[model samples]
Target: VNQLGIGNYLNFKDRLRHKNGKLKYVEGSAHRLDAQNIQVMFNDVTSRVVAEQQIAEERNFVFHSLDVMPGIFYVINHEGRFLRWNRQTEEISGYTAEELRHITSAEMIAPELRAKHKEFVASILSGARWEGEAELCCKDGRRIPYYYVVRHFKWQGEDCVVGMGVDLTERNQAERLALTYLKEMQSLSARILESQEEERRRIARELHDELGQGLTATLLSLKNAEEQMGESPMVAQVKHASSIITILTQQVRALSLNLRPSVLDDLGLVAAFRWYIRERVESAGLRVVLSVDKDLPRLPALQETACFRVLQSAFTNILRHAQAQEAQVSLRQADGNLVLVIHDNGRGFDVKAARQTALAGKSLGLLGMEERVRLVGGVLEITSAPGQGSEVRVVLPMG
Candidate 1:
């Protein structure tokens, strides 16, 4: 017999002779053989196998969940090298698993931001959590904005950091657009005040040039007629005075209509629009189409005025810039808001560049339309490209 090691302090292996006279090494030998000890060893091996299977299954589940997570998940070692990362991290950074493992976290930070990020990581390792917005450098030479949350952790008995981050690219873009619009609004406000003064000056000049001269001529003709009463000359002078008075009345009526169309105040939006389109647009030899929802509710006076001004501005732009033969204007209720759309099959321009120019004071008409819509809790969208028709869409909150 010889000693063996098999889950016990002592074991025995003996050479046994079979019935057919063949010799073999048997594990349960009679040199201090204990069945209870052998059974305990068997139980220990079974328990270990079951425990290992459960642990493997748990590890697989955790990895799978991490892979499908929406945000970027990553772990970095004490040396700042990537120890592990989820699929989202690879996608956002534009680096493969093999590439990430070979590079330190500093390489993923923007060049100008490396020094600050290093200190941030150092603070995290010292037990202070780091949470903030920063830009991460991508493999394709792009910088991706992100909001990150990071903290220190013990991974495999070594110091490390586990972090989760959300991409902020879309949010940042929205904020920039809002800021640009704000600047445009400030410029528009200044322009509005100037425009009001200019309009007043124009009205004064028209009255003085047309109405003032006509009235002065009529007064002189009447005075001359009174001096030659009962004479043929007096009859001729009276006839001249009547002619001058008739011409002055027509001029005054035209000016009154130009100042504020009475139809707009008496008959509402639809009636006013119809009258303007026929008198102004059609008379200019341009084809015009107007569509309005039959079931639209009565809107507030301010809202109605805003819509009218925006529409009027759109038409003017089409006439001045677009050389199209046809134009369409439509108004309807959609998704709890009133929507206005103006379209023309005319020469178009780059919308982004045009908007920039307008905001820069080169084109106040476009800026004014946007501002008018915005004041009534609405948005204006202009879409156009060179050689393609332009479309202006506005949405106003109904309430």
Candidate 2:
């Protein structure tokens, strides 16, 4: 046997022949065998070489990909020292390759998160994949949040853990902005609701004290004149005027109550709803079944108002849109929350379409109800479909 090249094996046999009284040596092997045999071995060797070259190229591409990837990539040894890191990792940590070599991977973790970092290392050492969010302490002493994933891997015959991290700065900032915007919106909605209530109360007072009382006085005057005038045509006209005044007074009272119910401000939510269902809903030919918990604790003014108004709007919508004959309203405290559900068996409409319409400003009443619920940090859900019953659920956090 003789070595031909790297990874290439060739078989050779030496034969001796007597040529002039001396032994002559000649080399003969698989390569020097029949032409067909040599061709077959050459082809097999060439195929293997080509395959190996392809594998090498693939590995090179993978390394290049890792280096140029937009995320941070790093390798840490069992001792938690960084063995290697990609360019992004270096840029994000504000450390060079040489500087990283002197520091352990744990050094890059924030001090408060060192315990969690240790746990991750232990888990990786035990062959478990770990993934979580952590703050990375950069070389400039600034901490940045990162979402990271690490797994145990064997690199160059050494047990190491490889990790990848994506920066969460932009995502976290966007989330914070969204939360702030939501809070602002809620505050604006609350203000608008407060203004609306104040206006309603003012109008109700004016109607009761001015319009209502004036109508009563006029009716009394007409009654006196009718009694003094004797049984004549003028007396009949006075009686007719008195009757019209009575109807007008009653109408003014009903309108005032609808605008700002005195019971809602005097009693709590339950009493108000009971009166509303009896006087408004049932009077409008819609049978209402109301269930309320006993001794319901008084909620904050905002929450109570929000809940009442939401129901009022719901009833209005039911009457205006839902052609259902009966409706159900329930209120109770469950799991630290005040839960209200209103269901109507009416010709329902598409809930999604209604919401889109409300967003488009066409359904101002529905939108107002939603805003009221959200102002109190509550959620409103409406379940309805064409030709199906509609259910509105409101959940308000009590604590």
Candidate 3:
């Protein structure tokens, strides 16, 4: 009223005690009618004021909920102005609340990803939900990978984007650890295979050089004894012993060759492969067609061993499980890599299930072949289905 007397009008809102002893809000106005008279009016506004207070309380609750969430949350306008953000946004970005408000969303993205961020925003604005991964650049220049999901909506009558981002640091670390462990396991397996080959070679040499020669000398002695004691039962017994000794010598020679074929060490991979196909595959009653590149050069010892072992394993599978009548083998050099493929017409098994079984340790032949190829930094692929034939393909780098 005092201000209205000096001026023309006055307006205000104030709380008052109601007749029933309750607090009420009022919006009041006063107008000076003349030098000595004034008009005053008061309008009840308790409902409007109470509703506004409730809305403010709810807004605060929502903000608190966002802050307690596990990941980064943020809201930005079409111009990329930060309208709201949670505690994680500031924490991960290494920026204070005030600093974030002054920067745009693109400013937080790594420079190389800023352009992509713009496209993501545009997509959201065009009414499509966006989800992808990007690197966030912190204030300290640290780049962190984050997977984000964003949507467009209206905030207080203004177009805005709301987004959530999850950190991928732990996931990436776990994957790296798994890869490292796998490599170590493969290296150990390669060493074991090398040791086994060495042992086999030693055993084969002993059987061929010692036991084989001993058996041959004994047979010669028995033959000479029979010649000296003619027309006697003792001569007949010595002759019989000579025949038995000759048979034993033949068996020993076969075992030695099967353990480690001397041809492999002396004549190289081609000779070894041809010998195996003729002596092993055909002897097992499986007709085989072999094609080789005439210009294929000799490979490193380990590589040649890996290739030969894989071939043996594949053919073993064909004979034991494929139930096929015929098989085909091919070896060639292309792009500085050795390519070997084997196919069989035998009844095939499910490749995926077989692989799973092999991985689970229920089967070792397939797994062993795969490990041999991997040890040499090569790739092995097996394809097959029930009622169809099976194929094993291997590619090894020559260098």
Q: Who wins the lDDT comparison?
A: 3
| Model 1 TM-score (2 dp) | 0.49
Candidate 2 C-alpha lDDT tens digits along 144-191? 889999899998898889999988999999999999998897788778
Worst 10 residues of 2 by lDDT: 35-44
Ranking by lDDT: 3, 2, 1
> Number of clashes in every candidate structure?
0, 0, 1
The TM-score measured for candidate 3 stands at 0.81
Candidate 1 vs candidate 3, lDDT winner: 3
What is candidate 1's local distance difference test score? 0.77
Q: Which stretches of candidate 2 lie above 4 Å from their native place? A: 1-64, 115-119, 125-127, 231-240, 347-350, 384-388, 397-399
Off by over 4 Å in 3: 1-62, 114-120, 127-130
Local error of candidate 2 at residue 341 (angstroms): 3.0
Q: What is the C-alpha lDDT profile of model 3 across 72-144, one tens digit per residue? A: 9999988788998999999889999999889999998889767777777777888999788878789999988
Candidate 2 vs candidate 3: the lDDT winner is: 3
Give all candidates' CA lDDT scores. 0.77, 0.85, 0.90
| CA displacement after TM-score superposition, residue 21 of candidate 2 (Å) | 50
